[model samples]
Target chain A: MKKKKKRLSLMRKRMFAGYLFILPWLVGFLVFYIRSIFQTVQFSFSEMSMDAINGGYTLTPIGWENFRYAFLEHGSFKQTLTSSVMNMLVDVPLITFFSLFMAMILNKKFPGRAIVRAIFFLPVILASGAVVDAIAMGEMMMQGGVSGQMQEMEASASSAIAFDIDYLISMFMNLGLPAKLLDYITSAVGRINDIISMSGVQIVLFIAALQSIPSSLYEVAKIEGATGYETFWKITFPMVMPHIITNVVYTIVDSFEQSEILKLADTTTFDMWNYGLGSVFSLVSTIVTCIILVVVVGFIQKRTFYYN
Target chain B: MSMKKGRIKKAFQDPYQRMLLGNDIKKFALTILQIAIIVGVCYVILSPVIGMVVNSISGDKDAYNPMVFIFPQYPTLERYKLVMLRMDYWPTITKNVLYVLTLTLIQVLVCSMVGYGFARFEFPFKKLLFGLVVVMIVIPTYTIKLPLYVTFRNFDPLSIITAIKGGPINLMGTPWPMYIMSLLGCGVRSGLYIYIFNQFFRGLPKEIEEAAFVDGAGMWYTYFNIMLKNASPAVITVTVFSLVWQFNDSFFSNLFLVSPDIVISKKISTLASVIANEDKILNVTLQELYLHAGIILVLLPIILIYLLLQRYFIEGVERSGIVG
Candidate 1:
């Protein structure tokens, strides 16, 4: 009983220590982050548009109204969301597989590996707003920012179908299916190009997780006459299951929080001020993301996670 | 003090760390893959940048093909000069460097202390508070811009340098906000940094502290000698992370001090913002110069720091909670 009491006291003391240590972060976060999130939701509900003067909505609240605007008034909401998801569909998997692959490869021993690693991770260093802005400016000069040249390119390409050249592909076009699908796919790809550029950290995380796997398992597998593919299946895949869940959740959360793109388009539509709508959008996205995360993480726990 | 000579020797003898860090066939393939992936990744990341540079440099009057990746057949430095004259690059850059340094240092120290406390001590409300930290991990900092902007709008930059704007006390459009942010360890990636420190410090051997306590040493003494010494890995890691994250964190600085009142250099405008705002940087004739200059200016500090801290940064990343 005395030993039990001592153990209990020690546990209590350790727990208290942990709490005290993390206090500053907690206070700062509540003061800064939480209230802002609350405010953002509030701001979303109110009508806002960027103007020559301070760009914002003249704050007002209209319940479930912004949803209507997003869904009913502008079809672009669904389009952009779909486009974002589609981009993610391509971007996330490509990033994950490639990063994981790179991570695995990097985990190997080789000469000049440090230099290579630095180069690979250099993007994380370069992904600053400064770089982004510089790149954006550079694009403006070459692409003419938002000039009609791009539109002209699309127009010219579309017009290509009108010429004698049309005869060769006329049968394919008349089926009407391929043209529409191709056009839609191109447009969708163009829409979410911005989000695809920001997967540097995801790559790093995949690499780190890959490194955590023990080599003894591989050696054991080698002794067992296991092939590389088999080792990946039986060892690597199971070892990094937690990272998969983490990446999925992180990607979803990031996709939602970076609503800056939408917030821009919102400026033009529904001139009414509504913070509630903005908040609602954030809340809805976050909720959806969280739900997806919980389910996925839960499933992962059951199917893959093993107690040590 | 019980120095782990045995452990140190064993660590030196440890084949795994040496094997991992040292060169071998596995490392060679990884190095190649890294180079390839880096090239691909860099191209994507640099494409828009190359585009921006092209846009800024092109001699075209009404419209330059910014996305033009082909080297500008006519590269010019006129835009660089224009941005310099227009943006007040020297003063602005000085201010930026100073601001980043002040903010990073304070934040590092505070975060280290707080992280140390969390990792080593037994205190109250530990789990709940730690949970709050975890929750803050996902909590976006941008959400607080409005209120904090309001709160700090009246405050002043703290006592730092004489040449800086906003006096020794201006918060509105001053370095003070970023500086204060560091003290709280709440900058761009400070949350993660704190978490890193926590994890690193937690891994520390408790025997050192316990022995210190047995000797009637105070908390500060134990912390400085035992915990801090043992926490070289964490410090190195946190410092590098802080440097890099603070260097690149354009979002918060842009949002906070983005007003016109800010002097050209001390402000948080980075290459990304300059590129984003290329049209306004200088007139068309000097666009090319601005492009190259912007890249140099924005990247120079971080690049230099990165080079200097390369080994340490890698060390930190490795010592960190996760990933190499």
Candidate 2:
């Protein structure tokens, strides 16, 4: 129809406008992304040296030596990479579940709800590299008790609570779980604070998803005489399914990107001037991360129910 | 006999009352559990912060004293004084704050435009372009830092600037790299912000925009006057996130800024290292105290910002489900 043609022209106009709007970012993407990715790959395979002839460095192709060094020569590089990937495998799910659970709890009507929400979000504010490092340092001081003085400080400070963690550990030891499993559990326990801190953004994301769910859905379930538990399963759970995937993806990328081991790679490249080796580490890590993301997304996409 | 008869009468009088009594006990038990969890978690979160504060104020003698647990009897600002003298805290903080604020502002404007583009229109390669945006979000900045560093160091993309300048211009140890990245929507997490905005703009009703179109407003006008006015929540979210992230971003800042007065996160790290290495006169415990003081100094601005904007920050986050 003539009307349909007219609408098509309008769509074309809108598309042009859209392109115009995204022009700056497009320019940036062209300049930065494609070029950098190419150069990164190039740098990974070459010996980079300062060129006095020109201002910038020159790359002489060295083949797969950088990659080989990263894999074969650097002992800790492979170890850290594997361990970090393993950590992400555990951390991503744990963070997603923890955030979702906490979000559900915090979404309920409670006294001091605002304060509780703020408390949960306090981590996002304190998520600075400095603060994280500082907290880690503080923990080290506590655990190591750097001096006799620090030991006194700890004893006086913690004397009131007396949780008797040793007793709990001993009891768990007696339960006959394998030693490796017990070690994992203990380390996980130690990492609970880190998990809690990292989950702040995910928790907020889940909370927002929870809030946007139509109250009418809950009312409909209630009218059918659904209990609180049934409503959660039948309504809340399905509605928030997509956000779960988002949180999982976000958490996975975050863990991999910010892992302590990746930081070591950064220092190696930039600080130690091991550009070739560092690029290999960076490239491999990026590939591993992409693989994990694709796998996770594919799995989650099957379960994600898009209503609209 | 009278007591037994009374009990039987009371039980017979109201089954509803008996149910209410049972409910009260359940509620009480639930409340106890809630309180315990909340208190425990809060303590775990706050303990390090408290430690920093306590150590910052505590005298050297207090660290040795078994009796001084929370506060020092002779609280002193000596550690803070040492940190201030050594770190040049004020100049560094001022520069860091200015840089973060300006960068945040630029990112908010640039990214929202990019977001609006993705959200509002159908274009060729739209899917592919947006996919690239998603890739930008996924790939860590460290991976590309080398190339980015070279790109900025040369100060030319496609050699146009080099052609103009007759040679490459080195821009290391300067703010141009950050400025250029932010202006072009390639700053830290710029892609994420664009995605957030794109999602938000898509969620907005189309009828209002159509009305603006009918009123003869152009796309830019509709976006600036109509869409932006209604997109305050998204703006707030982006701004807060950009601010916090930029404030916390030590890695990139450290890589770029070779100047004396750099961002707080970088400054704190360097100061901690310097103190750890340089303080021979101070005991191990006192050196630790000074480091803690330095940490507190760096955290003060961010903590203040959070306190001031807590309400908007909460609303911004609560409304960020559009991204989800």
Candidate 3:
């Protein structure tokens, strides 16, 4: 009885230490994240106006007007939101699978592996902020002037290649593959650049997952005389299941960050100076993303195999 | 020739030898396929970057020339010179680097502490707290951008500033908002960083901490001396990630209206128009060349850092305990 009491006291002490350690984050989360989120919801239900007489702005309660404006009245909000969500739905799985495939390849030993890995991760830097913006601007400028000629030149250059995508499609059709599957494949191929650029971090996560799998498991499969294909299904696939969830979550969040809806929100808030409507845009997107995230993560969590 | 053919036929008839040859062929074929896929994907990734590099170097004559596709006929450093001068490249980059580095450092420290706490101890509301962390990751920054802006603009947390200074103090234009957020473990992507560290710490064996406790090392001592040393892999991953993200971050910088000198990326969006107006470079295509040059300049420092750290970064991720 005395020993149990002593152990309980120790547990309490450890819990105290835990809270102490997390104190800063707790304060920051409540003060910044929660408060801001609350304010955003509040702003979505109110009208914000500048107080020229006073120093700051004021929010007058206006009910569902802002949300009604967004859903029913706004021209591009619904279209942009649906398109962005559709893009995420398509991009997330493609990125996850492609990253997993690339990770498996990169995990193997090869000459110039380090250099190839560096090149693959280049998008983590380049696709983020200023560089991508500048590149887009430059492309837009070029399109107006020189890109027409450049596209023609590219057409000729690509025509010199012996293998044609059209020929491949025809061959696949001759083989009687489903047209729906073929359409998906062709679209994925078209978005190959976006897939490659977005999958860098996911690839890293998967490589780490693959690395952490115990070699003993493979040895056990080898002793059982399993083939490479069997080993992958029985061992490698299950071992990396947990990371698939992580990568999916990451990919979804990343896709949302790059989505058109967020850009629309930015323009609405800062450029158009429509704070209430801007809050409505962002809040709706966040809620939708959160729902998708919860449903998907929960589904994956149910199936994820935690080896350790 | 007949004797050699008989010998070869006999060798092929051996099951072990046949299997070995088949395996070798399979391996070789797979290697060839892997190389093709990797090279093709790399080209898809690098083509635009390569285009930018070519455009940045091409002179006015090459810009207009239809035949100049991949290579420039009249390559020059003029665009780089002009962009560098106009962007005030050196001073701006210096300030941005310092700001990003400071934020990265604070994020690493604060996040690891929080992550360690979540990983190691049995605390009440741990589940709720961790759920909040996930919420942080899932919630769009745009959802909170305006309120966060207002919060910092007023700068009266708990009305302490009001009580002390008689009213609110504006932190909009200063670096304090970012500093405070980072210091308190709520900086850009801090939730993800904390999650990573938590995953890493959970993967570490409990015996290490037990041993430290047995030796009379307190929690903080054990954490600082033993666990943090063993967490080098996580540290390297976090450091590289934080550095890169913070360096490229425009969301917070723009929301706070941080001075252009302190956030060089903010300058990049307006660089073309600035050049068009100031240098009288009215031609859009030429302005684009200068913009590309400016982008390359911005990318050069981060690229150099990435190259320098690439070896360790890759190795660190391989060893990092973010398996989940």
| Ranking, lDDT, top scorer first | 3, 2, 1
Off by over 4 Å in 1: A37-91, A107-115, A141-196, A206-249, A259-273, A297-308, B1-95, B105-142, B155-170, B189-242, B258-285, B313-324
Provide the TM-score for each candidate, comma-separated: 0.64, 0.80, 0.88
Q: Give the distance in Å from residue B244's predicted Cα in candidate 2 to where it truly belongs.
A: 1.8
Could you tell which candidate, 1 or 2, scores higher by DockQ?
A: 2
- lDDT per residue for candidate 1 within A43-139, as digits (tens), equals 5566554564866445546656777776677545566665654554455455556567666766565666566555555566666555556545544
Candidate 3 structure, TM-score to reference: 0.88
Task: Provide all candidates' interface root-mean-square deviations.
Answer: 6.3, 4.3, 3.4
Each prediction's DockQ against the real complex: 0.21, 0.37, 0.49
Instruction: Return the clash pairs for model 2, or none.
Output: none
TM-score of predicted structure 1: 0.64
In terms of TM-score, the best-performing candidate is: 3
Where is model 1 chain A poorest over a 10-residue stretch in terms of lDDT? A187-196
lDDT of each: 0.57, 0.76, 0.82
